[model samples]
Target: MTHGRSSNILFIMCDQLRHDYLGCYGHPALKTPHIDSLAERGMRFDRAYVQSPVCGPSRMSTYTGRYPRSHGTTWNSFPLRVGEMGMGDHLRPLGVRTALCGKTHMVADRKGMERLGIAPSSPEGRLMAECGFELWDRLDGLHQRASGKQPTHYQARMQARGYRTDNPWEDYANAPLGDHGEALSPWHLSQAHRPARAAERDTETAYSTDRAIEFMEDAGDRPWCLHLSYIKPHWPYVAPAPYHRMYGARDVIPVVRSDMELRDPHPILREFHRNRVSQVFSRPEVRDRVIPVYMGLIKQIDDNIGRLLDYLRKSGQAQRTMIVFTSDHGDYLGDHWLGEKDMFHDCAVRVPLIVMDPSPAADATRGTVSDALVECIDLLPTFIEYYGGTVPTQIIEGKSLIGLLHRSRAKLREVAISEYDYSVRKARVGLEMPVADCRMQMVFDGRFKLVNVVGFRPMLFDLAEDPDELRDLGADPACREVIVRLTRALLDWALRHHCRVTVSDADLQDAIGGEARAGIYLGCWDQGDIDQIIRSGDSGY
Candidate 1:
């Protein structure tokens, strides 16, 4: 695979995969044989991050090469504003053939999908087609499992065989109910929860891998950009039988470091932890059961990656293709007594990023590692630069990592930014909710991390010293100057990127008033700690 010439780019992404989960990354427990093998033959990034800690924002950042705020998508359900220029849209004009298989959570309407070449119209289809991809295996209803109608032959078979539901088979529903028994749990009745899909009907790696292989074979001689996205290792914690049973619960170590919790941590953290302690940790046996199930989900995703890698090797395209494996964001997985994401903490923001260079280096940079700070936004430009495609000016905020990829240059950027919005927070609480008024930001430069909490005092940590983030050096007299410098950096980056600005006094007043206006059931925590607060009142009424 020569550089500057036409080459196949295979982009593999997993939902909610964390960096610490792979064996190569030093996770004593996780069994990711395929990913580890890929790491051995590739360059791994020790400090890769996502623009946002959630699905929509992170994926948007990766595809557009722009910050979430810059791209205008800060939360889920808020579609990437139509006409927003993205990597796919920009790639279409070039001669490269673009194709995507599996989970594309980015918004693409019917017209835009057809233009991108997807047989079925999905939110992501139009955007990919518009970008220049002509081949696609469209699966729109894979995520929600097409409701009253069947969308694909696989889905049709799933419906015919039937699924297991908890209640009267009619009201019981076909999908697996990720139990929302904890009063504060996001799965409560008042929460707009739905069984994502039947455990048996879930689309595994086989579904997407086969499609990608078909695309590669059909592509024949022409150079193509294939976006191979996987939806596993996310939600419901459901994996197929053998995968589900692969890991024994006894072998898995449930390690929740009390230190990961920040002192006076974000209000949301407090609330989530309280629920975990009461509803989950209180029942050790039940908590034990959840880990194995979650690990089972991860194993399934790994197996899927194995299948894809095997296909590439068998087809003799292994050496010719530039392979990149990453995740939209990291899952909490009970770290710091938390489950889902939305925090500036490393467990939430830090993600696994592996880039396998196809060209052979002198010493086989294979298994080489770089602790350079990189974000999801950097991906698009890196690809564009590698493919000789022009990067769009107005929308792109990411710097290309091609230098780091080609020559192992580490000092690309001093800091990386991640954003979070209030919509999902409010929805998790209850609604007809007022807009989220609070914001949090992180500024980390390899050695140090500064967390800016709106209205509340900012927190600074010498990560090199305080690895678990248990100590708060913000108020310490000795580190005051360090705090001041980091604060300035955070503000400068925020203002420059337009991601966020220091909260004003007026903003604080607005937040207080907004919390009152939202009409949420207040309890131990106040509006300032909204993230830590959960509406336990069973009034879906």
Candidate 2:
């Protein structure tokens, strides 16, 4: 928080939270006072994006400070390939203990670990197995009702509270009690509006907050980084007690969509429209009920965040910890006639980013809004710099934002990049794309947005003219130059991605003049020639 050598980091991430849903981002009605306070006391970025639009890939990029292509986990349930250094892998040896209290959506690369003979029971192997974090208490919370797996710890806790059922996660935590005393699934839009059967404190958001507090209390004075993540404001879309009824249909904003987007959509976009989530959310009748419940869950998170902020101040950790609040990716929620966040729409990739730096250098930029185009990977370098370490630019693909936070002259970036591989999705079949050809890449230069699919025509939009992204200029012959320009920008970014992570900038510099040092002189006619070459600092080493 101050200029401490080993400062703590509270990286708070929420699931499926949209950027425009927060009051700090100008949501007219949803009063996220706690999150808004972070913006009021810190630097808020107007254009922050994640590398991928789904949970696993986006978070993997967030943790590793690399692109999804480099991390090799492009979709949910895909294991981050072992040996990819994560936040903990980088910070732990530097005297910072990294821990997780909620979801990371990181599927373990157990087979890779096994091939390398890393025992699963070993401490190092455990960290590798969990995306490099010591689990304080983890709950992924996307439990399917028909999995037939053993009930989760949350379910066990529900039983402990006398709310026993076949699937307590769905029965009490995600379902609402009907008039006839039957538990109705929140999957039904009409039933989704009803309050969950579980008490407010027993909900997932509250539970994660409680566990995060426990982790803080147990951490003592040692410098630590706690990734406090939440699992609500996502699919099941149910809130407990009064929070469920916080807002009604009248409070919801006008849906930013039109019938025109459905006409002559891209082949990939058309397939997305066929998705059940997309179709269901496209209906106005469904949106009216589900959106309010979604709003309620966010309100609940805000309240719990308030609780955490208060505890931090009272416990005196507030001034010594860097608090970052952001979401992995924004939810589509039927915007652009799509659902479930695998697209390049701002509604899917853009996210709210607030950093509350307590150091005096950051005082000048406090409560300021930056319109710089930034990505999720930037946080790793920012954290590395805050802890007084040099950012290893070879593997790290993001520039540190510490200068911006400290009110230094900002270096503006031309474009922000987001990548997604859709080979694992059901849409691949609908689009008839080969597994290798299912990748989707987006390049946005604040106004012009370009999306390229491996086997199809690129989708382009001039957001300046159509801020809601209602027009597709990809097929317009008059806009061909714009498409070509953005396509070149995408190529430039791709060429810059760091793949040789094991190599360092220092290693590269040393290699430059190593020929003379090794006595393997190039174009040397005699020993004297080699000697003269070695004598000068400009020697071709």
Candidate 3:
């Protein structure tokens, strides 16, 4: 089937952004007019969850349309195995070109690539190619302390622009001025509140936005998918001069935590709180200082999104392109006494999902909001379906969102799941737990969220009552039925979707004709059946 000219996709992803930080998602002070514009003309999901709460695994799920366990890339820097079909693989056959302009956080499976004899210098061997995307202009945009190591592409560009420090990415882009006129490093937890020394145009967000525009302008008349991934609002928590001063202590929201939450917390939660990330965020003074900078970074991202949207409209691409704005995951920002994302709290797992389909068919549901339980993995299938491509259900586990986009009330899924494997971090932190015990999985069934750790007690929260997730109902005897129901649901989900990469029993039965096989074995039972089988054998059975 031929796809329409409006089948182009602009998949925008921001790092470590929360759902409540956007104006469209009901943020009171944050000005995201550009992102809000997308919501005004499209469908916004009120309850969207990532497949995982970390960058690498979450992005893997997005690209592959499968869970982390299914893809085998469970954490940051983990490689997606070679030969695994991704969005690009599925879309390219349907005449859509898939390209990435910015960060993918995809560590190529070096071993697999080598075993398959794929050259690293070849287009098919680069990180983009391995992940099923063509490399338009790759820039991960992270260059903190790469003194002796090879600098990132963004850092090289900074040097070419006359920012000539040993680590300009850290000094000019991430550091703030001190009282003595020195570069106060952002890595210092106390100095994370300072403004960045780099100019607004020189920031990573600006660079990524510019590159994305270049890709869009150069894409001529073809249905293309460009992943305009931006590495911002993630860490270094610093923004350029005006954006840094955009918010202050007055704008900071109060940290969400209580004494009751700390009391008899789960072992994993207790360990996380003791970690450096949680320890720094738990302090009142630190929260007061850092939250504002984090807010500033998000505002900068919003402004950049505005710039990109304006360009698309001016270029006449806005009417034909399907714009999807979302994040890999979210930051804790002192929520539930955590800083970086690791656990399964709403702050870390739930992200803003805004999809704007520009086709005339989608006009009826424009600006509508859906409360369906959506996951990040659903995007690939959605893109496939939008391009009029057949979704390879045997490989892609996620259901397409076409029904939801059309304003259908029929539910695509009843539960969303997220998993994290913290064994490496646990071992580094000297935690006295088994390697398998460091993992955790979360299952949310629209209302209740159940977090099951490998070797610890489960944690449950009734989102209807405790949206903050401060109260733990896992230990309550009255909520045992709820726990049992969700647990069984999660178990059934895992069992059904586990790594059965090949054809199933039903598929095999259908592939080889059911009655034909039986008739072939019945040698002397029926002369008529035997004759039919003998005749079919000669006709390429």
Candidate 4:
């Protein structure tokens, strides 16, 4: 395919949003018309999975097109090593400028940047730039902890807008009003029902959306990839005004869980269920109160998406821009008796993936829903292919969805992989295990999902039979064959992805007599070479 203006990419990422929450994904109540419109105009991936089920590692995979193990950013707050290349590094050479407008959850490799002498103020030193993006507005969205003593830019802006308080972000944006009209911080689950004191235009979502629009407007003739990352629907569980009132407990979907899941649950599952956060979510009252606000946040995101799309159409960029909508990872929201994201359950790993390629070639597949196994890492390669750039097969561990978008191929991979390293939270959860034993890896084929945990029994679920994942067949003697098959498949996947840091085996084999063999001293290249070697040896002796 030839490169054109249609190659521009608007990569929209929401935080901790579940795949099934959107209206297009068959949500029974929540009406996400804007997001649904994107799905209707593009390809909706029903089985898309993130590389990791956490924020940082998942976003790292999305930006770098590498697995968490490959990139070495295994969890939130973990830095992506300095040498790892991001989409910007790959796309910039091809004249595609990548920019970021919102949250990246990127923990900079200060040591790497220091060794390389890349100042934080420099283009390559900025958080967004570290991931190969130019920063239009880099807002990490958490005002409470903005790099030690610094306040978040969003908070600063809110203060500038006269929403001043000791901590305006928390007091006005995240906290709800008490009976006496005092700030009720979100730490209390009851605050989930309270509407944010911040005005609609001052919310983090609104700020990100406005900044994204500004960046798109400022982007010149050069093809650009704007990562419009929103930090909403994540935490504090509060929405502004009408969105907060848009839904109540009635609108929330029924939690997909069963008491059977808790009976003799896996050790990790048991620990997670007993965790304070999970315990809170385990309550029906908490779920009823919190889920509505969560839904409200999603509604706000949908509305902002509508605004962004409207801007694109009005500005004539709609026809030429490829719009990608996805989340870093899914939120559990009490599903499976867990809250927040960290588990291998589909609620935490599977995310909404809708790609609207504006090229005329995509018309045939427009509004098509694909059940192909796709990974978040694939976005990098997809953008590369869209812009006529070569996919760095050696570096990127994902396949481009160009074929699927163009209806050239029916499927991409046989199975999707997701990994989580919960070692950092082991101590907090009172687990007295070594960090190495605190991790879990999951592999899901279309019908079956297997979870492999270090120092723990593996979990197997037949999605075909138990879509809710209420049953554990890991210990079932009858399910031994399925377990073995999945274990072997996981092993194969690990073996294939292991030790990819250096030259691949294929490359090494291909270089048998190539430049890799250059300057080598064979037994005797020639009589003259032999004579020179003999003379040199005699002189040394």
Candidate 5:
């Protein structure tokens, strides 16, 4: 395939959206018709997983096509190193104008830039600063912390719309207005059931949708990729007036957890369950108060998706533009006696992935679902393949799913990997562990999932038999073989993905006979060998 000159990509990402909540994914109550249509017109991956369960590291892994271990930004606030390349760094050179609409959770490597003496005002510095994205409207994470002391685009828009509160985001946008016009803070779970103080159109979700459309209009006729990211369904659990009344406790799915999971919990998870978020979610009423609003936020996201799709259809960009919809990670929402997405349970690591390739080549597999194991890093290479760029295997560890999107999957991956660094999490503090020892690795083959901690025994779950993951077989002598096999697989995976980005497959292959051809033949003793080396152009011998 050559460069897709007429092709555009709408990469839609939502924060903290789960796979099971969408209509197409078999949700019983929530109706996400717009998001479901992506599956009907494209491919839905049932077993997609993120590299990390947090925002920054997972998004970095998606952007860079490398593991969190490989990229080195292992937590939420950690900065991506200066040398790491992002999706824009790869796609921009190929004429795909990559632009951001909402949050990337990107923290720039200012120290590395200073050491290299690169000015932040320079083009290269700016690219590194924004994780290689050409910004359109960067409403990153919150109204206040978009950057240190810099007022955000969302804040200005809110204030311009007559919301003159001290903190418009927390007060007007996220807060609920009482009957007497008093502010009911979203921080309290009791007030989360009421509608937000702001109007539906002025909420961040609506603003993000409008700004994405604006970005597309500005990039008319150009081969561009608009990363239409939304910072909703993530936190504060607040929805605008119209959506606030959409659901209640009756609409929320029954929580999938068991008391048995709490009895013999792993040492690491024991501390995690004792944390505030987990303890708060562990209650039934708390879930009833919060989950309905979460459902509303997801419904709000689905509606915006419909608006974006409608625009694409009307503007005639629907036929040529590829659409990839996914989330940074899954929200636990009290699934396994946990919350806030820090564990390797399916609720935190398993994410939704749907891709629609608007080419005739994808006709055969359209509307089909695949159980093939996938990682979020696969998106970067998929974009590269769609744009006809060679995927540098040395730099990108993920395999492209273009083949799967267009045709039958040739083979299944041996295992899917995910990791979490609890160094910044309260779990580490409660346990009083060193930063270096505050991490855990997960290796999940098609059936069994194994998590290896620094000093504790491995935690294993047989997903095939125990889909709810209510039981742990790590301590059972009967499951010793499964543990040993997965441990070996993990060891092999870790050793192979070492820092070898500077070395390519061709470079390593050439080196096999390169030294002998260079005529410094260490083992050559015969005159015929020396004569052959001399007779060769370079290595004809």
Candidate 6:
């Protein structure tokens, strides 16, 4: 079970990639040879969720070993605060050569830096340095409000590098506009859009992979941690050719087939479905064509992953290296008529988590599926525990998967949590454009899910009964007890994480009814007595 001095760690993460899209996860149409190969050589987790469903929050949670609340980052623009610890800080002290390539998405702001679990008051450029990464290729931040169809920054960089300009969107069915609802254009094929000619080159992917391979190959006689992040399979899903045409247009499997059902829905879920239907799943023919391209992106990522693994094995470092493959979050891919990961659906929250040990086991869960219910937060503790590092009990909220890896998954937590705090909450509610005070927390116990919106009714879903989550069981009379039980659990969990407003049992009962509970207050409740708390400064404990 021990490795040599040059034992390395290759951490691969894909943006907005889903577990179901891969062949190893029972996707009948899509071909994920590289992903399947990794599973064959490692262990695949079936029920893995993110601490936060959004890109920035999810990634932040992975690096910090804390949920969004504990880490103090619940949205995209917010940064991890200073003095908060992270995996980078942990690894640096161990003398490991640390490097991050592609997109780290760690913002450089007082708020963002803090939420990233770094020092809050550090100088603008100091967070990255203080993150303890020896090498970094951070991309320039793009203004989300920018008006442009193309990824201008990416395109410009690619053009400068003489990247190919051929069928750019060939395998990028998720590309915005241009190819919207287009026919099965043979132009979506590889020879038509070669990688060498990708007009919009992902410097993150090509350069980061190259950098990772170089570092891994050069790290002789020393241990290292290299994070190779891929940006493809995210938005503007363009990938190089041959990859785009790897599967037939009809071969791409839609993880979320269009379903108009919004049983007991919330406004956010409603808006999400509307956009998904219009943007990606408008027609059956278009749906058929888009999937192949999406799969193409996954295949491209898999190809790069293979390249990294091959290099490690060729250099005789495979047995000494620990490989972990996962995504920041899962993409909707036309499920429930949605295409991204902002919502609380399983398709958005559950991602692919595969861990490969250098010491292969005869009875290891290699190529097998496990529903032990893991999440991104566990990553930090897993590595720390694996390497025998000093992990403070307070900072780490994640449980290590090493036990599961060793087949001793006893006393694991029954639930995983994620949060969101977009400044646009009121906009979502049709009240204002940017309600900066909005916050949401979601608690999932693998079977049932509860989402507590600061200003709305919490959403509850029975995943066992409705795996698609098409039915919202939050207000169902049949699930009333379930809702109350989960609500209590969610409130206690929130209070433990310090993200909730407290209210006393007496005040709550006086405000809502005789049955008010002692737990976290999601937002300003509108009950007469609860309203009195808002007015009397006793907003219920």
Q: Estimate each model's TM-score.
A: 0.77, 0.95, 0.92, 0.92, 0.95, 0.77
For 227-281, candidate 3 gives per-residue lDDT tens digits of 9988888887877878877887788776778888788887778878877888788
Model 2, 99-153: lDDT tens digits are 9888998888889988999887799888987788897877887543425767666
Worst 10 residues of 1 by lDDT: 165-174
What shift in Å separates residue 307 of candidate 6 from its native position after superposition?
Answer: 1.3
Query: 184 in model 4: Cα distance from truth in Å?
Result: 1.9
Poorest 10 consecutive residues of model 4 by lDDT?
512-521
lDDT of 5 by residue, 201-263 (tens): 888889999999998888977799889888889988888878887888888788989898889
Question: Can you tell me which runs of candidate 3 are displaced by over 4 Å?
Answer: 1-3, 127-130, 143-153, 179-181, 427-431, 502-509, 512-541
TM value for model 4: 0.92
User: In terms of TM-score, how similar is model 1 to the real structure?
Assistant: 0.77
Per-model CA lDDT versus the true structure: 0.65, 0.86, 0.83, 0.84, 0.87, 0.66
Poorest 10 consecutive residues by lDDT, candidate 5: 141-150
RMSD to truth, every model: 15.7, 2.2, 3.1, 4.2, 2.2, 11.1
Candidates 1 and 4, the one with greater lDDT: 4
Tens-digit per-residue lDDT, 155-214, candidate 6:
444446554443232322223223433323333422222232332234345555776777
What's the candidate order when arranged by decreasing lDDT?
5, 2, 4, 3, 6, 1
Task: Please give the distance, in angstroms, between residue 251's alpha carbon in candidate 5 and its true position after superposition.
Answer: 1.3
Candidate 4 lDDT (Cα, 0 to 1): 0.84
Q: RMSD, model 1, all Cα superposed?
A: 15.7
For model 2 the TM-score comes to: 0.95
- Which pairs, if any, clash in model 2? 512-541, 513-541
Candidate 4 structure quality by residue, lDDT tens digits, 4-116: 94458999999999999999999999999999999889999999999998889999999999888788889888888888888888888888888888888887888878888
Clashing pairs in 3: none
